[model samples]
Target: MTNEFVLEAITREFPESVLLSSEPYGMLTVEIKKDDIKKVIHYLKDSSLEINFLTDICGIHYPEHPAQEIGVVYHLHNMMTNFRIRLKAFMTREDTEIDSLTDLYAGANWMERETFDFYGIKFKGHPDLRPILNMEDLGYHPMLKEYKLEDGTRTDKNDAMFGR
Candidate 1:
C-alpha cells in the first residue's frame, strides 16, 4: 500500500515543504516547516497512510550545530503497515513555537509538554502546555550544548566539566 495520498496531500497543501524523500519515506517527514505541521499531520492521518500512532516526541539541542537550540523529534507508527520512522523539526530558542499535532494524535499531549520542558519550544494548541518536569521558572533549556552556570552565566558546561 503506497502512501501516495499523503504525498499528494502534502504537495497540494504545502508546496513549500522541504521534501525529504519519496515512496518509503514519502509521508515520513516534511522537515517540519513549523507552520504547516498541523496540516501535514492531519493529512497523514486522514490519508491512506493513517499514521495516527504517535509513538513518541522529543527534542534535541545542539548549540554548536548550524541549527542550534532545539530539534523536535517525532516517532510515528503506521498500524496498517507496521512501519515506523523518526521525524525531526528544528527550532531556535528565540523561535520556539510550532504547530500542534494533538488534534491528529492525542499521544502528543504529554510528549509536546515534555519537549517544552527541556527545550522551551511551544506547541501551539497543546491544550495545556505546562512544565511536566523541572522547575517552572527554569527558562534555560538544560539539554543544549551551551548550558549556563548556576551563577547565571552563559559558559559551555562541557568545557568546565573537562577542565578547559
Candidate 2:
C-alpha cells in the first residue's frame, strides 16, 4: 500500500527492467528501459499492484545528457487506494521511438500524440500518431532545449506589460 511496498513489488518483478529508482517528495519514481516499458506498465495494471489509472504521459528534454536527451514520463494512479507512481524511459535524440500505450490505456492516444508533437518522440503502434497541438509540418520540436527561449528581435509588445 505504501510507496516502498509498491516499489519493491515492481523491482522484484522486473529487476533488469528498472535502471534506477528514487523517491522524491515521498512519491516513488522508477526509470526503466525503453524496450521494457510496455511490459512493465502492463504488469503494473494487471498485477495486484493495480496501478490502473494513467494520469498523464509527457516528455522531458535533458539536452546536457546526450544518452538521455529525450525522456518520456508516465504517471500512473491506483484509484482503489489512491496510490501513485511514476515511470520514466529515456533515449537519445537519434533514437526516440517508444511503444504506444493506446492498447493498454485508451486515453494514451492523445497524450502520445502530444508528446510526439512537442518532443519529437515517436510512439510505435499508435493508431493515429500525429501532432495534437502543433502543425503537421512544423519541421522541429519546439519543446526541445535546442531552440531559443525568446525572440530577441521581437519588439511588438511592451516590456512592462510582458514583465521583461
Candidate 3:
C-alpha cells in the first residue's frame, strides 16, 4: 500500500507509541517510544499490512542530544508490495537497554549483537548478546563520537603531507 495508508494504520493502532512521523527519501519513517518498539514492530509484521521482512537493525549515537543520545533503527520491508518503513527508538545514554526483537525475527540475533558491539546498546531479552566484531575486552564502543579521530601521541606521521 501507499506510505500514508501504512502510517495511518500504525498511528491508529499505537497512537501513544508513535512520537513523530516523517518521509525522508520517500520512505516512511516513524519515531516510536523506546519501550514500545517491540510491540509496534510485532503489529507491523503480523497485521494486514504484512510488513514481514526485517531488513536491518542498527544503532546510532548522537552525543549532542543528552536525553536521546542512543538510538536503534529498524528497517522493515513488505517484499510482496515492495514497500518499506523505518522505525526508530531513542533512549538516554545511562539507560541503553531495549527489548530484543529476536522473538519476532530470528535473524535479529546477529544484528542485535552487532549493534551492542558497536554502540553499546543492550538488548534486554537477547539470548547471547556479545561482541560480534570487536574483542570482548575492548572496553568501549568505538562507533561513539566521544572518541578522538586521531591518536595525538603518534609522531611518525606527517600531517603536512595530508594538508592537516
Candidate 4:
C-alpha cells in the first residue's frame, strides 16, 4: 500500500510544510517547520503510517549559503508496510531549537543526542540533551563550515591524487 490516506491527512494538516509528495512510489517528503516538527512526527507515528521506528536523524550545515544553516533529516520506517518516510527540518543558528521527538520514538534518544553533540541543535524536550560521542569539554561544533581551520586541512582532495 502507498498510504495515500496518511499522506492526505498530512497534506491537510501541514499544507505549507510539505515540500514534496510522491504518491506513485509511496514516498512522502515533508519539510517541517521548526516549531511544528514534533507535530508532524507524532502524526506520522500515531496515524495509519505505522512509522514506529525512527531510523536516524542527521544534521547538515552549509556555511557557504547562510540560508541553509541546519538541516535535520529524519528517517522513519513503517514496520507494517516496510516503507520509509523522510522528514526534514531546516533551521539556522539564530533559531537552533526544534521540538523533540523523544516522546514519539524512544529510539530517538541517542540520535537526537548525537545531533546535538555535533551540530549544536537543541532538542527542546530531550530529557538529557548532552553530547553522545564528543567529549564534554568540546565546545565548538566541528561539523560546521565555520569551524574549518585556516590551514585548509579539513578539505584536501590532493591526498586522493597523490596517494599519500
Which candidate tops TM-score?
A: 3
Cα-based lDDT at residue 59, candidate 1: 83
Task: Give each model a TM-score.
Answer: 0.73, 0.92, 0.95, 0.82
Q: Count steric clashes of candidate 3.
A: 0
Q: For residues 1-164, what per-residue lDDT tens digits would candidate 1 score against the true structure?
A: 44454555567766886446443434455465656666766666776667778888888877766554567877777897876555667766678788878877777888988888877788887899989988888877666667445544656545568577
Displacement of the residue 26 alpha carbon in candidate 4, Å: 8.0
After superposition on all CA atoms, what RMSD does each candidate show versus the true structure? 5.2, 2.0, 1.3, 3.5
What is the per-residue lDDT of model 2 for residues 30-54, given as tens digits with 9 covering 90 to 100? Answer: 9999999999999999998899999
Per-residue C-alpha lDDT of model 3 across residues 26-73, encoded as one tens digit per residue: 999999999999999999999999999999999998999999999999
Clashing pairs in 1: none
TM-score, predicted candidate 4 vs. hidden true structure: 0.82
The candidate, 2 or 3, that scores higher on lDDT is 3
Clash number by candidate, in order: 0, 0, 0, 0
Please provide, for model 4 over 10-31, each residue's C-alpha lDDT reduced to its tens digit, 9 standing for 90 to 100: 8898887776655335566767
Steric clash pairs (candidate 2): none
For residue 66, what is the lDDT in candidate 2? 97
- Model 1 residue runs over 4 Å out of place are 1-13, 19-30, 66-69, 148-164
Candidate 2, superposed: residue stretches over 4 Å from native = 153-164
